[model samples]
Target: MDIFVVDDERIIAETLAIILRNHGYSAETFFSAEHALASIGKSPRLLLTDFRMGRMSGIDLAMEAHSRIDCSVILFSSDLQECDREWQMLQKRDSRCTLLRKPLHPARLLQQVRLSLSTEPRLGLHVS
Candidate 1:
């Protein structure tokens, strides 16, 4: 299963990708939503994106990608309260969407990833 990590901060995206890769998962990093969208054909099993970004927000990217593919989306934001409305709207649209706060703990991130994958069989992902 492939995991795509998107963050405007290059280090964050790359580090997340490396961590996922180290854990026996195939992963890639994208510094921009546009670039990630362009590569949607890769059909990532999961999307780990920063909620606030230049030009496009993570919710927007997830919505567009979910429209095209059946994948689980995990959005991270430093300011969670600011995106409450957006989160509610996304949940109404797709229950598969999940939120995680920024400055993520490695263990929590991995747990969420596994939980998301296990819970959403439509994503066609096998954890083991």
Candidate 2:
């Protein structure tokens, strides 16, 4: 499955992509939401994005991407409390949306990706 990693910080996005690639997944990296959105064709199997971006937030990216294709989104944020309301609202609208706190452990991120892309549909919110 294809995965897209979007982050304003180039290093973060690239590093994540490399990690996913090393794990045998086809992954791509984008430094901005606009770049990723413009490049998205059929939508990837998963989108791993940073919640707080300059022009477009991860939530915005997720919303737009969801409108175009059926895919799962995993949003990473440093301040989870600040986005709690928005996250809950997103969950109500899209059961496939999930939130992972920043400073993520590589193993946890991989686990979440697996769960999000699993054949068995996962319901409700996932915060880690």
Candidate 3:
């Protein structure tokens, strides 16, 4: 599946992209929501964004992505409290969005990604 990794931290973005690529997934890294949104038309299967990005937040990205593409979104934040509202909003959307705490265990993150992508039907494009 094609995935977009958006994080202001270059290392984090590149690392996640590398891990996704190693697992046989097509992944790209972006430093901002704007850059990531530019590729939404490509219809990536997943959007992995940092919750505390400088300009545009992950919640905003998720909302825009839901409108523009069929993809599951995984929002990562170091502060769990900061994610509470966004998590609730995601649950309301019912569009397969998940909140992932930062400083994540690589293996655990991968597992969650697998679960989110599997349960999220919109990630796959319908040819018909």
Candidate 4:
């Protein structure tokens, strides 16, 4: 998979995936982090996941994906404060994670995706 768009909200997840697909990239949608985790690691892929979700938060999934496949992650949430608190624990020089707020524009999402995939190592936490 080129990218995994995960969110508890079905519409958001699918819509993001569709947008990515329309942009000429492979994309998949998962309604829960667990489902996405189960399907990952055949190869490293980028992840665009909602920060808060069932069973596991996006940060939790990102940590696991990094450990398993060194995947890049883009975590989004309406709850900015909570996302920030959780993300602070994971920031490091070699980390490849980005945080975005909700109501994300399609242009911005595409921009982030390009940026995330264009680079290999991403240091610090990129928030927008």
Q: Estimate each model's TM-score.
A: 0.91, 0.94, 0.88, 0.91
Can you write out model 3's per-residue Cα lDDT over 1-128, one digit (the tens) per residue?
47899999999999999998898888989999989988788888889889888788888988888887778888888887856766676667754777777786789778867876785363321110
Candidate 1 steric clashes: 0
The local distance difference test score of each candidate is 0.86, 0.88, 0.80, 0.83
lDDT of 1 by residue, 79-111 (tens): 888888888888888877788877888998898
Candidate with the larger lDDT of 1 and 2: 2
Q: Best candidate per lDDT, number?
A: 2
- How well does model 2 score by local distance difference test? 0.88
Candidate 3 local accuracy as lDDT? 0.80
Error of 3 at 101 (Å): 0.9
Looking at model 3, the pairs that clash are none
- Per-residue alpha-carbon lDDT of candidate 4 for residues 10-78, written as tens digits (9 for 90 to 100): 999988988999999999888999998898865546888998998898888888887788677888988
All-Cα superposition RMSD per candidate: 4.5, 1.2, 5.9, 1.6
Candidate closer to the true structure by TM-score (higher is better), 1 or 2:
2
TM-score of 3: 0.88
Q: Which ten residues in a row have the lowest lDDT in candidate 1?
A: 119-128
Candidate 2 lDDT score at position 99: 90
**Candidate 1 residue spans exceeding 4 A from truth:** 119-128
Best candidate according to TM-score: 2
